[model samples]
Target: MNFFSASYNSNQDLLDHLKSRGFLESETVYQAMKLIPRGDFLPVELLDSAYQDSPLRCSRYGFNASAPHIYGKCLSELEIEQGNSVLDIGTGTGHFAALASYLCGSLGRVHGLDIKSEIVNFARSNTETFKSKSGLNINVEYFVRNCFLADPDDNVYDRIYVGAACPKDYVHQLLKALSPNGIMIVPAGEELLKYVKVDGKLKVQYLLGVRYSELELPHQHEIQISYIQHEREKSLKVLIPKNGIDQSFRLLINDQKFSDVQLYILGNKTPINVHSFIFYCRIPSFFKEFIEPQQINLSESPLVSILLPDFVTEKNLMMVLEYVYCAKLIDPTIFESNNSSPDQVNLELDNLHETLLYFKIDSLVEYFDNVSTILQNPQPFNLFQDCQSKHLQMLVQSFNKIPENIGTDYTFHFKGGDIDIISSETVPHLLEISDFYDDQFLKSHCESILAKSVEIDNVVCLYILSSRLNAKQLFRICKEFIIENYPKVSKTANFQDLDKELLCQLLQDSCSYFQLLFDRNDSKIKSVELNETHSQNL
Candidate 1:
C-alpha cells in the first residue's frame, strides 16, 4: 500500500559481472539482482569478494550467504512474479530476501526466518536499511524460528526457498507450507531438490547440488510417515540419483581360469570346472558339507573334484544350477530338440522338475509350479508317452509300493547334510572307512528282497530305511507292524536273509513276538541271554 523509487545504477558493474559468468538469466531476476546491491548485504571487510559467484562465510559457526549464481538458480526455480507471496527459510544476511522482494515488486511481500536470533536481527536490520537507503517500496518481515512450522489450513505463500539442506522426508512440511501451484527448493543429500505441489501431492526433481547446512525442524510423529514413503521410493531408485557403478558374478560362474570348482556328476566322465562363488551359497545343503567359500586355495591343492550319484544326471544338474544363477531356465540347447516340437518342450519341463526333486531341493520347486499346462498335459497333446517326471513320481509313491525299490536306485534323503555328495559306489567306500557318511540308503540287488507280497521283506527293509535315514515316522510304523504280525512274518524266507543286527533288534524290541514265534518255548528265559544265543545261531 506504499510507493517509492530510488536509483539502483550503483551496482550495475556487479550485476554485469554476474551476467558475464553465465548466470542471472531471467530478465526479472537479473533486474532484481541489479536493483539489490550486494555491498549492503555483506560485512564491510567481506565486501571485496561479495561479487564473486561463491558462498561466503556469514557466521563463525560455518554458515554462508549463498553465492550469487546459486541464489539466481533458486530464484529462477521459484518462478517468482509480481504479487506472489514468498517465505525464505534461513535468510542469512538478508541478501536472497532483498532480491526476492525486488522481484515481487510493489504488489508482493516476503517473510523470512532464521534459527539464531542474532542472525535474524542482523538480517532484519540490513533489509530495513536497504529499504530506506534505496527508497524501494518493500517491507520484508524477518523473524527467529528454531523450527519449520506452518498451519496447513492457512498456508498462503506462493513460493518458498529453503536456505539449508533438508532430509528426504522434509518434503511433506515443504508441501504443507506452500500455496497451490507453489514450488520449494531445498538440498537433499548431495543434490539440490525441487518439489512442486500438484493435485495435493508433491512431484520432485533433482536440480544441481550445492553445499548447505541441515535445516531445523520440530519433532512430530507424522515425520516417520513421510520418511517411510521417501525410503520406499528411494529403494525403488525413484528419489536417489545414480552414479555409474556396476557389479556381476557371471565371470565367476562361467570363466574357466579362476578354477576353484570341479563337479563330477554321475553319467559324465569330464569333471565340471566351476567357481565356488557360483554354487557355494546357491546349493547350501551340498555346500555346507563340502565347500568352504573363504578358505578356498585352488592353486595350492589339486582341483577339488566331487562325484554325484547315478540317479542324478549331469544334464539335469547343470540346468538347475544355471537356473539358480540366472533365475530363468537357460535357452533349450542341452538335448538338441526341435525348436518348434511339443515333445521337446515337455522334455525340458520334466527335466527341470526331476532335477529339483532328485536333489530334494524344495526351495526351487515353486519355480516350476507355474510351468505351462500344455507341457504338463500328456493325455491329449503328446503323440508319444507321458513326459512327467517318473523318477519323482516313483519316490512319491514309494510309501505305497513297500520294498519294491530293491534293485532300484534308492535316493538317500539326508537332513542337515550328513551324506557325501558323491556316487553311491564311492559312498559305500566312505561308509566303510569312516562314520562321516553315516546317512546311507542300501537296497539289495535281489528283487526277491524287496518283493511287495512278502511282509517280512517290507518290514525288514522299512526298519533298515527308518534307522539309516533317521525316519522316525517309518520306524514307529515298522515297530507297530512287527509287534502285530511278527508270528505270520517269521516263516518268510526273507527273514533268513535279514542282517543279524536287524534280527537281534527285532528280538530286543518285541519280546512277546519272540514267545509267539517260539510257540511258548522257554517263556521265562532271560531275554538278554536269549538274544546272545539267537545272535550266535544267526
Candidate 2:
C-alpha cells in the first residue's frame, strides 16, 4: 500500500501520534481536524496515510501539503478570534480552511484558493463534514485560481494565511488583502519561519527546526527585508509646555532630520496628549555631551524639555531619534553601549559613524567632519566602501553650498589667556552690536542662521529661527531637505498651516513654469476641451 493509503487507514493512530508531539493543542483544532476526513482530499494511492503527522505528496514536481504538526503550529500562532474572515492561499486539503472556519464561527468566513483544480475539489469534498457538524454554518469557499495575483474587486479579508513557504515579496499582495488589524501567518525564509502582518508589524518566533517544500507563486518582485535581531532601546515620554514659545522648536542633529521621537504631554496623575515625533538623534543625549556650556544655559530656559539619564553618543542618539521620528521601532540592542571613558566613547563613535554611513544618513558625514576637526584627526576613507556609493555621493553633493561672505571689523577685549578669562565677561552692549553687524551684512541672514541652527546640536536655536524665517523659504528648504535627506521625517513633523500654503504656492509656481515650457498644441487643446465636455455630460 502507498504512504497516503497507509496513513488514511490509521487516522486515529496518526492523530494520537500528533497529540504526543504536542501538535494538536486546542480542542477546537482537534475536533475540526478529526471531522474534516483527510482521506477524501488525498489521492486513493496515498489515502492510507492522509492523517499522518508527516507531509504527503499531493501533485507532481514536489507540490505537497505540510505535516500535521506544522499545520497545527501555524494555526496556533494565528490566534484566531471569532468573526474573522480568513483567506488561505495554497489551500491543499482544505482541512486548514475548515479548521479556520470552525474557529471563526457563523460570523466568520474562510476563502481557500489553489492553482490545482483537483486539489481545490478535493478540499471542498473533505470539508463537507464541517458544514453539517458545526450547524453554526461556517462558510468555506474554494477556488481554483492563482493566489499570488489578487482579484482587484476582493480586498475584504480580515486574516490571510499563506500555506506555502514564499519569498518576502509575496507580503505586498497579502498585506493588500489584510484589514488594518488583521494577522497573516506564513513560513518565510529557507530554514526559518516568520509570522508577519500581526498588529501592523512583523514578528518572528522560532519554531522547531525543520525544512518544508517551497510553495510556488508568480514572478518574483522587489521587496525590502530588514533583518533585526531582538534587542530593546530606551524610551522616554516628554511633555510640551502649554505656552506657544516652544512652537518653532523641532529636533535635529548634524543636519539630519529627527522627527518621530515620542513627545508626550504630562497631565494630572498620568501622561496625556502624546505627540509622536521622529528625529535623527536623541536630543537629551546630544544636549548632555556635544552642546557647549553656554548653549546649555539657553536650553534650560525652554518651556519643554526631554530628560534622559546617563550619557549616549550623538550618533546612537540620532539613530534612536530617526527611528522614533519615522514612527518605526528598532531593537533595543542598537542603543546599548559599553560605558567606558573617552577612549571607549571614541571607539563607539567610530562604529556609529560607520553605521550611519551604511544606512546613508547624509548629515552624519558633516557630523564626522566636525568631530574630526575637534579630534584633529582624519578618518579612514574606506570605512564605508561596501555601502551604496551613489547614496554617499548624493550626501556629498547636498553639502555643496555657496559660503556667504560677511565683511566685518570688530574688536574684542580679553582680560587673560586662561586664568583671568573667568574673571572677565564679554560686555552685553558689544555683543549686541556684533549681532546687529552680522545681521546687517548677510542676505537672508536670519533664514541662513535658522537653517544653520538646525544643522548644529542647538534644538532651541533651530526652533526659534525656524519660527522667524520667511515661510516660503523655510517651507521650500524643509520640504527639499526632508525629501532628499530624510523622507521619514515628514511623517512626524507638525508643520504650521502657513507652511502648507507656502508649499501650494511653490507647486503653483512650478506648474506655471511647466506650462510655459510645454505650450499645448491647438489640436491637443481642442481634444482636452472636448474630453472635459464629455466628462461633464457623463
Candidate 3:
C-alpha cells in the first residue's frame, strides 16, 4: 500500500507535495485544493490530521474524507473546468463539493447528494461557512436522496463524480444522468474507473486500485420512515409575529435619535421628528414635496422643518405617522378617548381614511374599509355590546395585517402565544360579511373557526349553512361529525331538519366509510395468516 512517508504541517505544504508527486497535474486542481482549507471540513478530534494524506473517518455510517492524493488524482482525471455543472454522489462533509464549486466559479452550479440528512446538513453548513469567509460566488446545493432511485429526467450534469463504490448494475442508471459528451469518475469494486460518454456509448478507462464502501439501498421500512418524516417536516407550521422591522421603525417614529426631517402640526409647538428615508420609500410624493426640496444631506445637514396645512390635525398626523412607520393602520381606539362615543370614533376614522387616500397609501386605505365593516357589525345578534368596541378594535387591527394564505388555522400570534379572535356565535355573521365583501382571506378564517365549533346541538344547522355557502372543508367536517356520533346526532331536534335527499347522501357516505374500514381489517388478517402459514412450512 502507498502512503505519505511524513506528516505535513499545513494545507499548502500538502498541496506542494501532491504537485511534486504528479498527483496534482493541473493548476485549477492546485488552486481549488489550496483555496479550500481541509481543516474546516474535518471533525474536531481529527482537525490536527487534516493535512495527512491518509483517509479520516467522518461519520458513523463508515464515510471518510478521501486522501488528498486520491482527490487530486480524481480532479485531474475528471478534467473539471470553469462553468462546468457537476454532481457529487455520496458527497460526505462536502469537502470535494466545495473544491468543485470553486473550480466551477460564478457561472456554474454544483449539487451534492447523501442519504443521511445529518451528513447533508453538515456538508451544507460547512459549505456556507466557506462561502462566507472566502466570498465564493457559486451555488452549491445539497440534498438528501437515494442516488440509486434518483430521477435522471429531473436534471443532468456536465460532470458527475461518485464518491462511493457503485455497484456494476447501477452504472448504466447513473450514466443516464450525464449530458452528451460528459465525463464521470467513479470507484467500482477495487478499481477506480473513468467513463466518458460519446454518441450514446460509454468509453471506459481504469484509473487506480482503491477500497471504498459500495453504495447500498436503504431498507423498505427506512424508506417509509424517511418519507413520513419528510412529509411531517414539510407541513410544520410556525407562528411568527408580523412586527419585526415595522415595530423597530415604529419606535423611531418621533424619536430624535435618527430623525432628519421635522413637521410642525397646525396647533402643536412640539415638532414631529421623523426619518426621511421612511417617507422616501412609503410615501414618495410626500417625501419629494416636503423633504426633497430642502435638499439637505441627511447626515450632515440641519433638521429641516415644514408647517402642515390646517386639515392635517396634530392627532390625525400622529396616527398617519404611526401607519407610515408600521405599514399597518393604528387601532382607531388608540386615539379615541375613553368617553368617546361611537359617532366620534366613526368621524375620526373617516378623517384618517381621507388622509391615507390623499397620501396614496392605498393598502392602508383598503384596511380601513374593512375596519368600517367590523365597526358596523359589532357582534353576532349584538350579544357582547359592552366589550364590542375593544374586542372588535383588536380584531380589526390583527386580522387586517394577517397574510391572505396564512396556513391552516386563523390564530393571531400575540406576545409568544396564539390568541383566538373568533367566537362561536360570531362565525356566521362574519362569514356573511366576508362573502359580501369578496374577501377570501377573511372567508377562509371564518370557515376554519366554524368547522371547529361543530357539535351535536348545531351540526345539522351548520351543515345546511356550509352547504348553502359551498364551504367544502366545513361541509366535510360536519358530515364526519354527524357520522361518528350518529345515534346522538339522530336524536337531536334539528336532525329532522335535514331534507330527504341530503339524509340519503349522509347514509351512503357513512356506509362507504364503514365498508372501507372493514376491507382494510380483513386485508390485514389475510396478510398475517399468510405469513404464519409460510413460517410453519419453513
Candidate 4:
C-alpha cells in the first residue's frame, strides 16, 4: 500500500484545472501542460481522477507524479527557451519530464533521474508510451541513481527541477551545475524556493509553502489564484487587541497587512478575510455586526459598493483610513505629551482638519481646530526667536504657518549645538498623534515662533525643537540668525547665563519666556515706551 493517502473530490479537466488554480502562470506553461496527457502517466486505478491536479499513487511508498500545479509553476518560472537543457530529479512518473521535453522542443536535452529502480523503469515505460505519438521529438534519458553522485556529461544545465524535498542548505550543491542565468526550482524543506545565478552568486526567492515528502505526498493545493488574492492560513493573528474594535475595523478596510482570503458577509459585499487565526481575536466584542458588513451603515453607495456616509466617498474613506493607520504607526511620544513637539502637532492638526472638513466629518473639525489652537497658543515648539516679550506678542498676529510640503533640507549651528533639518520628515513626525481630541496633544504644538522671538536665551531649546519636532524649516531660519550674529550673540549676557554648558542635551526645555509671559497676560500688549525723564519719575 502507498504510504500517502489522499482524498480527491474535485472534478475538473487537468489542463484547465491547474491553469485556473494558478499552477500554470503563462501560456507557455499551459501549452506545456497540455503536451503531456496526465492519464497516460497514472496507473489504471487512478484514471478516474487523471484530469485532476492531485497526486496519485503509482505504486507503494509516497511516490507522487507531481500535480500539474507543481510542475506548471516550476516550468513557467524557468521559462524554457527552445534548445535549453533540462534535468528532473526523483522523476517518479516521467510526467514532469514529458512536459519539459515539449518546451525544449527538438534541440533540447531532457533527462529524468530516480533513485528507485522500479519507479525509474515505470517512468521510462510511461515516457515510451507517449513520446512518439505525442508528436514532440525530444530525447529523454532516465537513470536510477542519486543525483548528488551522478556524473554529468554536460558542464551546466539551463533549467533543473527537483521532484523531492531537500533542506534549503543543500540548494548550493544543486546550484553548482546550473548555468549562469539558469533557473532552478526545488522544494527546500516545507518551502518551495527558486534559485537564480546572477553575477556569479545564487539569488534565492521564496515561491510559496510546499509539502514534499518521501513518506507522503503533499495535500492537493489549488495552484493559481487571482493576482490580488492571498491565501489565508488558519494561524494568522488579526490583531484584535483586547480593546481592539478600531483596529479590526481598520483591518477590514485597509486590509493591507492582512490575509487575502475573501469573506462573504451580508448585502453581497465581499472583503478580504484576513489570515484565519483564533476566531475570537479576529472579531471584536461587537463582531456580530460583521455578519452583515453592508449593515454597517445605512448609507450604502451602490455605485461604488462601499458602505459610507454622505460627504466621504469610497476613495476618500480609503485615503482617510490610510492616514489613520499612519497616525497609529507614529511614536505616541511625538504627540502624547512632553516627548513630542508643537509645530509637529500644529502641522498634523492642520492636515487632519482639512481632511475632516472635506469629508464633512463636522464632529472632528472642532476637535482638530481646538488641538491646533492648543499648539499655536502654547509655546507650540521649543523653537524661539531672539525678540523680547513685546516684539514676540506683536509677531503672534502674523500667524505661524505650516507648509503643505517641505522641499529643502538645511543645516543650523547654534552655541548650544549643530543640527540638520530634514524637510520631508517634519509633517509625518508631527502627525504621529493618534487622536486630535487628546488635550495633551493639542497643548504640544503652540507658539514657539513667538517665544524664540523674545530671547535667544534657550538657543539649545531651539536646536532641540527643530531636531525632535522636525521643524527644520522654521528653526533653520532661527539657526541662521544665530550663526550670522554668533560673535556678538555669544558675547551677550544670555549666552553666558545658560545653566547647562553644552548647547544641546539629549532632551532639554524648548518653550521660552515669551510663551510663558503670553499665557500669563490677560490682555494684549500695546507698544508703549518710556523716555529717560518718565523712567526717572517712575
The best candidate by TM-score is: 3
| Prediction 3 global C-alpha lDDT | 0.71
Q: What C-alpha lDDT do the candidate models reach, one value each?
A: 0.59, 0.48, 0.71, 0.52
> If scored against the real structure, what TM-score would every candidate get?
0.38, 0.38, 0.43, 0.38
Cα lDDT tens digits, model 4, 386-456, are 21222112212223332322111110111111123322245332222111111122112322222234245
The best candidate by lDDT is 3
Task: Give per-residue CA lDDT, model 3, range 357-429, as digits (tens).
Answer: 6666665555567866546644322110111132222223323432232311222211111325445655675
- Model 1, position 276: C-alpha lDDT score: 42
For residue 436, model 4's alpha carbon misses the true position, in angstroms, by 92
Worst 10 residues of 1 by lDDT: 238-247
Model 1 vs truth, CA RMSD: 29.1
Q: Over the stretch 1-538, how does candidate 1's per-residue lDDT look in tens digits?
A: 1101122234676557556655667788888787786778887767777666567786653478777778877898888988988889889888888888888877998888887888888888889888899998667888776434433224468888988888877666666677878888888766888888887777889878667877876654334334443443332221111211001222234345554557777766777676443343345454445555333545556356777665456667666655544343433333455564778667666766766765445545653464443235322211111122232222233223323232122222121122323343433222221121122231111111222222555676656655564444345456556666878667667666877887887778678545443542333345557778999999
**Could you tell which candidate, 2 or 3, scores higher by TM-score?**
3
Please list the residue runs of candidate 2 whose C-alpha ends up more than 4 Å from where it truly belongs after superposition: 1-9, 60-62, 129-136, 154-156, 192-199, 220-538
Give candidate 3 misplaced runs (Cα > 4 Å).
59-62, 218-538
Clashing pairs in 1: none
